[model samples]
Target: MTVLDPAMVPPRDARAAFRDGLVTPTAGWSAGWAQANLLALPKDRAYDFLLFAQRNPKACPVLDVTEPGEISASIFDGDLRTDLPAYRVYEHGEQVAEVGDVRDHWRDDLVCFLIGCSFTFEAALLDAGVPVRHLERKSNVPMYRTNRACRPAGTLSGPLVVSMRPVPPELVATAVRVTSRYPAVHGAPVHVGDPAALGVADLGRPDYGDPVEVRPGEIPVFWACGVTPQAAVAASRPPFAIGHAPGHMAITDVRDSAYAVP
Candidate 1:
C-alpha cells in the first residue's frame, strides 16, 4: 500500500509535478487557492475545442488558453505543461500515458486550456457552513456520468459528468447561494436530490472517484464537473491530448475572490 505523506507533497509554487517528483492524486492540498482542470490539444484542433467549450459553457467553462508551446496561462501565471502535480496523456482517444511533466511531449502545435474545477466550489460550501463529506473523510468526491447530454461543439460532445456532495436538506439552499458566486469554477449545483433522476443507478458505485456514505437527513447534490471535458476528449480520441490527473489540478495565482461576481 502507498501512503500519501502531506509533508512530502510539493508546495504550490513548485510548478510541474515532475519538478517535485509527485505522481499521486491531488486532494486536500492547496486548500484555499483555485485549481484548474487541464486540456491540451494540437493546434489544428485548438479552435474546435475552444468553440466546443464556448458552446457548452456549463460543463466546459474556460479559465485560460495558452499559446502553442507555451506552458503558462494568462489567468494564473503558471506553466500548464509543468505546473500540475500529475498529467494524463491521451492519444487518438485512448489514454496513452501518465507522467509528471509534458515537457518532453510539448509541441509547437499544441494549445493548452485551463478550465474551472469543482474544488473552488467545495471551498465555498465549507465556508458557508455546509457539510462536505469527502473533505471530512479525506477522500476524493464521487463523480458520475449523467444521462443529460452536453450541447455538441465540433467533435466534442458527451454525457455530462457530475461530482456529488451529500448536503443536509436544510443547508442545500445555503450551498447554492455560496457556490453561485463563482461562475468561472463550475458555479452551482446542476441537480439536487435523487441521483437516479439523472440516470445514475447506484450511489455506492461512481464512474470516477470514491463513494461516501450519505447519512440520514442529507441529500446528494450534483454539479457539472471539469471531468466532463476529459470524457469528451476521451470519446473524441484526438491524436494527442493531455490533462491534469484527476484531482491533481493546476493551482493558479489568480485569487478566487476575483471570480466572485457581484
Candidate 2:
C-alpha cells in the first residue's frame, strides 16, 4: 500500500506533487475538492466544442471554460500546464504523447475546457456509507466506452464513456440519492447491472483505470464520465488537442458542495 504523507492531504500539496513532476493518478488526492477532466483544442473550433458539450450533457458536463491561451481557472487558482498529473497530447486525433507537463505543447491559440468529474460525488458516497471500491482497493476506477452514441455537435461526436463502481445491493438506493445531488458531476448512475447492455464485454478488462472486484452481492454501477470528451477528440480528429490522461485529473480548489444541489 502506498501510504500518502499527511502533508499530501491538502489540495495545494497534491498540486505541488504534480508540479514536482509526479505522474501518478490523481484519485484520492484532496478528497473533498472537486476533480475535473481537461480538454484543449484550437480557438477556431472552440464553439463546436462548446456546442458538443451542450448537446451531450451527461458525458461532458461543463464546469469551467477558459479564454484562449489562458492556463488557469478562477476556481482552481493554478496553472493547468503544471498542475495535472499527466497530459495526453493529441495531433490529428491520434494521441501523440503523454507527458507529465504540457508547457511545451501549450499554444496561444488553444482553449481549455474543464468538465465535471464523477469524483465530485465520491466524498458524499463515502459519507453516506457507500463503499468506493476503487479507493478501498487502491486503484483507479474502471472506465469503458459504451456503444451508446452521444448527440453530435459541429466537429465532435463519439460513444458515451462511463466510470464503474461496484455497489453493494443494500446501498444501491443510498448511492443514487447521495450522488444525484451533484448534477454537474454526472449526478447518478446511468446503468447498474449487465455490463453487456452497455456493450462492455468484460468488467475485468476496462478501457481505462484498474479493474476492481465486484463482491458477490454487489452490482456494477456505471456513471457518465468526463473522459468522454477525449473519446470525442479521438473520433473527431481535431487538428490539435490535449487532455488529462485517464485517472489523472485537475484537482480543483472548489468544494464539492459548490456544484451540488439540495
Candidate 3:
C-alpha cells in the first residue's frame, strides 16, 4: 500500500492508520482537520470532571463527549479505544500502561471527553507564515506542567500544562492572531517571551513530549494544553482513568473552521 502523506490523508484514514497499530504524534497529520485529546473516566466520576473542565475552559476546551459506554462521538466517528495512536491508562492516578489499543483495559462505564488540541490550528499558523518547529523536526510538541494550579472542582485539580512552539520574533503577532481565532483549540498563547515566567526552569526539559530547538531570534510561545486533564488524573488520584498520550491526539471528522472565529 502506498503511504499517504500525513498532510494529505483524511481524518478517517489517519485514524485507520492508528487502528492498524501505527504509533506517532498527530501534529502534522490530516492537516485541515481538528485533533482532540481524549479523557475517559468512569461514569461515577463523570460529573466531577465535567465541572472540572467547565472551570478550566482554557486548558480543557471540550469539543465532543460520548455517553457512558459509547466509543464514538458526533465529532469523532472512529473507535475511541483503537483510533488514537497511543493511550495512557491510569489507576489511582498512577499510569500503569501505555498502549496502542485500550480495548483490554476498557470499561463499559467509561465516559469519554474529547478536548480540543492545538494541532488543529497548526495548519492555520503555517498558512499565516508562522513556523511550527516540532513539525519541521518530525517530533512531538513539547509540553510543560506549570507551577500554577487550576481552580479546583469537586475532587479534581492539577497544575496547568502548556505546549511550547518556537515562533519567529517577527511573526509572533501573526501566530497569536491566527491561533486566537480558534478558541476551542486553545486560542492564543498563554505566555510568550520568558519560559521562566511560567515557572518553566529549562526549555530543554519538558514534563511531556520531546523538546525541540528554539532557533535564534525565535520566541518560545506557550499555549494552554488539553493534557492538563492527565495531569489532574495524576494529582487528583482518580481510581481509574484513560487519556491520550501527549501529542498522540484523536483526529476527528470535524473541520478546523468549525471552531474558528472572526
Return the top candidate by TM-score.
3
Superior by lDDT: candidate 1 or candidate 2: 2
Write model 2 residue lDDT over 1-262, tens digit each, in one string: 9987522477788888898998877767787889999999899989998999999888889899999999898777888998999999999889999999999999998889999999878889999999999887767899999999999998889989999999999999999999889989999889989999999999999998899999897999999999999998899998999999998999988998999998
Model 3 Cα shift for residue 70 (angstroms): 0.2
Q: Which of the numbered candidates is closest to the native, going by highest lDDT?
A: 3
CA lDDT of each prediction against the hidden true structure: 0.80, 0.90, 0.95
Model 1 residue 187 CA deviation in Å: 0.8
50-132: candidate 3 lDDT, tens digit per residue: 99999999999988889999999999989999999999999999999999999999999999999999999999999998889
- List TM-scores for all candidates, in order: 0.91, 0.97, 0.98
How would the candidate models be sorted by TM-score, starting from the highest?
A: 3, 2, 1
At residue 242, candidate 1 shows an lDDT of 89
Q: Model 3: clashing residue pairs?
A: none
**Candidates ranked, most accurate by lDDT first:** 3, 2, 1
Model 1 regions more than 4 Å off: 1-11, 14-18
Worst 10 residues of 2 by lDDT: 3-12
| Candidate 2: regions farther than 4 A off | 1-8
Worst 10 residues of 1 by lDDT: 5-14
